[model samples]
Target: MKKIMIFGAASAIAQETAKLFARDGENLFLVDMNIGRLEAVRDDILSRFKTKIEIYEMNALDFDKHQELFDKAIQTLGGLDAVLIAHGTLPDQIKTQEAQEMIIREFNINCVSVISLASIAANYFEKKKEGCIAVISSVAGDRGRQSNYIYGAAKGGVTTFLQGLRNRMTHSGVSVVTIKPGMVDTPMTAHLPKSPLFAKPGVVGKGIYKAMLSGKAVAYLPGYWRLIMFIIKMIPEWIFKKMKL
Candidate 1:
């Protein structure tokens, strides 16, 4: 059984993934900004499985306090076998274009904070010389689009950062898994129209857990996003600029 730490425990995907771990008898250290919602998730998981559960209230953007949080979780769990960073904010591209402050705030939330948290996890895993650091990026990070370029740009930064970290930890026995998920039905994405392409949170979460176990460096879920983004990335810049995504 794994000793797992999830930074965004309250997120639908993270919650589902935690459940998967619980069912398998793994221990979990869950962190989220919403204490009430976090408590609900903790209770629900404990109700169904006989496993160790710990919850903490935290704002993901609070980078200054991240080291303390990671240390505490590691100490409580005895040792951590894996970590999942799932907290992120979707930025409005239109508002980002209208305000420089919006761009800064969005970047801070989606990129800066992620870098800070990943650093803490990476260093710990590197020293241990065995562990998995899985981060939930997005397929949008594969390329920029007219609609959500701001959010995509932030995710792109995370993808690139993971790439470099993966390179650095190549011989350290630590696996860095970058999970790029396509559209998923969640409260955060409630405004978007529903479709067959939009996957369920539980489905995506299970895919992520499986990818980590397989030690895959990069995974595109529900899988076909790989082909879709391949075509998008292959288009000529001139022709691409002329058409909408």
Candidate 2:
């Protein structure tokens, strides 16, 4: 059984993905900000799958604590075969724009911390010469739209970082998968109206699981997001700017 560590294990998408891993008989080290929710997910998963699971409480913004958490996860899991970094925040564009601190806080949580954890994991995986590092980006990262440019920028940074990391890790046999999911229905988006474009967490979670296992460099969840983003990216800047996204 593979030992996998999932950051943000309490999230709907991460919980669903963890279940898939458990179903495959993989042991998991789950870390999240809320110990209660983490434990809930652990208990729920254990109720169905006979696999070992460990949980740790950590605020993703705790930059200095990142290495400590990774160390702990490695020790608890007995050696991690893979890691999934799924922690991120969906920020309010207008609020963030109005408050500089909010913008920085959101950016740090969504981009800086992710890169920090990924860097730590990359070092360990590079030495082992075999491991998978999968992170959840968003289709929003593909381009900047007025609707949510702040969130878009942060995810874009993550996507770009993964691209560079994947390039460097390829020689070391480390697999880096960037998951860009479209609108996923979760607590994070509860205030937003639902549409056909909105996908259930389970669907996105399964896509993440498959991408990690297959070591895909980049994956667009529900797959069609690829075409959707491609078409958006192709739009001419002047005309695109005229149309509100």
Candidate 3:
């Protein structure tokens, strides 16, 4: 059975992804800061799939804890075949503008923590010469709109960081995938306006699973968002800046 570790497993997308993998008999190592939610997900997975599911309370922002967490996961599962990075913080943009600390926290949660985890995973995969790292970035990264530019900036860093890691790991047989979801319906966006292209957590989760299996380097969840973003990206800056997206 393939061993998979999901960081930020308390997330809606992560929970759905866990269900998919559990049904396939994959051993899952679920990490999150919320112990209660983590246990709930663990129980749900075990009940539905009769598979091994371990939950670990983890704070991604605590860089020192990463090695310990990784060691515990490997010890429990034996080894890792794939890792999903799904944790992120989306602070209100208006609040971020008022507080410098909020911006820093957002960056630390969304970008710095990801890099820390990726570094740890890279070392493991490089030695094994086999592994997959799938990260959940955002379509907001494609273009920094005024609506959520800080969030977009953080995700953009994640996108670029994964690209760099992919470049370095190619020869080591380690694959890195970036999942850019446009507008996902989750607790994070519960209050956001409705959009025709918005995707459900399960939908995005399935897309990530398929991408991992297919060795896709980068993907847009729901697929159509890929074309939409492509066109948006192609528009000249002068015109793009003139109109609200």
Candidate 4:
């Protein structure tokens, strides 16, 4: 069985993805800020699949603890074949713009912490010479929109970092997959108005699972987001800037 570690195991999409791994009988090391939610997720997964699972409580912003957590996971799982970094926050755009503190904190949470963890994973996997590092970036990262540029910027940073990391690890037998999901229907987006563009967490979760296994350098969840983001990226700045996204 494949040994996997997920950093944001409590989130909806992460939970779904974890379940998929369990279905495959993979050993899992799940980490989240909330131990309660982590336990719930572990129990829920165990209800369906009998697989080895370990959960740890960790706030994504705890940069200093990242190495400790990773070491613990490695020790517990014996080894790791793949890792998924899924922890993030969808900060209120208006509120973030109003306060520099909010923007910095959110940015650190969404971007810096992810890069930190990925760096650790990259180093470990690079040494192993065979592993997968999959992260959940977003289609919002493709292009900045006035609606939520702060969050977009954070994810954008993640996407770019993954691109370079993927290149560096190409010959090392380490698969660095960047998963850019569109508007996913989770608690994160509950306050926003839903549209046909929105996708369910389970669908995105399944896509992430496949992407990691296939060693895709970049994957747009549900696939259509690829064309959609492509069209959006193709739009001229002059015309695009004048209209609402």
Clashing pairs for model 2 are none
Output the lDDT of residue 231, model 2: 96
lDDT of each: 0.91, 0.95, 0.91, 0.95
Tens digit per residue, CA lDDT, model 3, 1-245: 89999999999998988899899999999999999999889988888897898888989889899999899999999999999999998878888978999999999999999989988999999999999999999999999887788999999999999999999998899999999998888999898887887789999999999998887999999898889889988999998888875
Write the number of the candidate with greater lDDT, choosing between 3 and 4.
Answer: 4
| Candidate 1 lDDT over residue span 1-245, tens digit each | 78999988899999988999999999999999989998999999999999999999999778789999998998999989999999987766787889999998888888888889989999999999999999999999998889989889999999999999999877898999999999999888888889889999999999988998888999998999999999999999999888887
TM-score to native of every candidate shown: 0.98, 0.99, 0.97, 0.99
The 10-residue segment of model 1 with minimum total lDDT is: 88-97
- Give the Cα RMSD of candidate 3: 1.0
Question: lDDT per residue, candidate 4, 46-147, as tens digits?
Answer: 999999999999999999999999999999999899999999999989889999999999999999999999999999999999999999999989999998
Candidate 1, superposed: residue stretches over 4 Å from native: none
